[model samples]
Target: MNNYNLNHLKELESEAIYVLREVASQFQNPAILFSGGKDSIILTHLALKAFYPAKIPFPLVHIDTGHNFPETIKFRDDIVDRLGARLIVGSVQNTINDGKVREESGRDASRNALQTVTLLDAIEENKIDCAIGGARRDEEKSRAKERFFSHRDEFGQWNPKHQRAELWNLFNGRMNSGEHFRAFPISNWTEMDVWQYILSEGIDVPSLYIAHNREVVWRNNTWLPYSDLIKLRPEEEIVEKLVRFRTLGDITITGAIESGADSLTKVVVEVASSRQTERGNRSDDKRSETSMEDRKRLGYF
Candidate 1:
């Protein structure tokens, strides 16, 4: 007797594809919350594979914080153009201008938390009943509380205890009017799984993930890229270093780590042995132990 079974990566891929198809079948309007990061890129790739021979049914929606790395924006546009996919961008700056939110001020200032309002507004404006994302439970404690299909109330609030139960690959997307769902196809994947799959599948990620020389400064225990949003104290000097980001977000809040893993194989190997979670470098999450959970309650992806 010959035994045939899917490998570990294939199992994760199958689960993600199943979740994507379920989102399509369960919701009237759906979208992918693309951030030009590796996770979102992988989500888009899996979505493409899920409905091959036909264009992805839903559009890609990005909540632009107006503080992104230039390389990220370029990569986002190039991939969208290549896929001929519809792109909708909700600007945080615009939201700030409209008095919907205020930009944080001071030396530790960042617009990272402000993304919640913009994301919520975007959801309502687009009438998106379900927003598909690439968040993984292994990323953080708050994220660990997430279900495959997370429901948001009419005001876009998430109550973890009140979320519907998911069992045996069965998802319940039932919700009242004015409510929506946040579907995570890759909810169970870990950082290691993502990198290994990316390597195996030959998926292209932004150049920021590869080690390269860039101007950075030490801040909040990590190397932060020099950008207009940051204020350098007199003692802080901008120095060049070979670094790579494990996660991508607004340049103001996202931090990079010194690394020599310039290739995908090296990245996967590095990830396998690393002790810190990828988001450990992010300054926003350091604000509080529950910072991510707090943001989630306010509709931040």
Candidate 2:
């Protein structure tokens, strides 16, 4: 039984590695979107395994929202240094300063939605034909519509209706000039599968995922961390709590959950018994039922 479970992970790993290799072979200018999130971390690890003994041919791209957790940034830099890989950062702050995107207003304002413009800008600026992302189909409804090679139109908009069919394990990276593809190497991976694989491989993840004491405020039915970017409501009060983030994004919108799972093994156990999805804490998705799908159409990742 243990061997069977191990082989399941090996199969997923093989599929991800094959997809990464396909991206390298098919695209002239391909880059992996590295957000320092667990999914992206796993993607980077698979890319390394896919091209062992040779330096990864593609660069790592980050769409910096200027609102990320400091630990995420630190982890990103450390990983890049360890890998000896090139990193390209697209700043959402720069996009705002350049009048390309406007920041939202009020206490609920977040830079989460503004990352799309920066991502598109980076892809165009870098001439990236294929942008490999760590998005998984099980994470959200919009992501479920994605193929192994998700196509983006000339304007970087995703039209689910126009997506090409992937028969068998075959993928078509062909696209017209001015258009590009958003490839998801681990599209079929589930949250449990990711955690199990991480444990099996002994991969390191950001510490924010582990339970710790932090000052947070109750907002939007989740524990919103106290950050300078967040505007405190008149009724809201800051209080320290044992919390951990399931998904990391702009700190303003990424909420934490009360947890006692301080270690990876405990985290895996917690995930198994939890009823809510990992993304349940993310406030951005709470805006609407189709919020993620809407964003994808507008070129948001």
Clashing pairs in 2: none
Local distance difference test scores for all models: 0.93, 0.93
Candidate 1 lDDT, 155-246, residue by residue in tens: 89999777787889999999899999999999989999999999999999998999999999998899999988778998899999999999
Per residue, candidate 2 scores C-alpha lDDT tens digits across 1-301 of 4544547788999999999999999999999999999999999999999999898889999999999899999999999999999999999999999998899987678898999999999999999999999999999998888999988999999998877889999999998999999999999999999999999899999999999999999999999999897778799999999999998888888889999999999999999999999999898998999999999999987
Off by over 4 Å in 2: 1-6
Q: Which whole-number lDDT from 0 to 100 does residue 267 have in model 2?
A: 92
Task: Give the poorly placed runs of model 1, Cα more than 4 Å off.
Answer: none
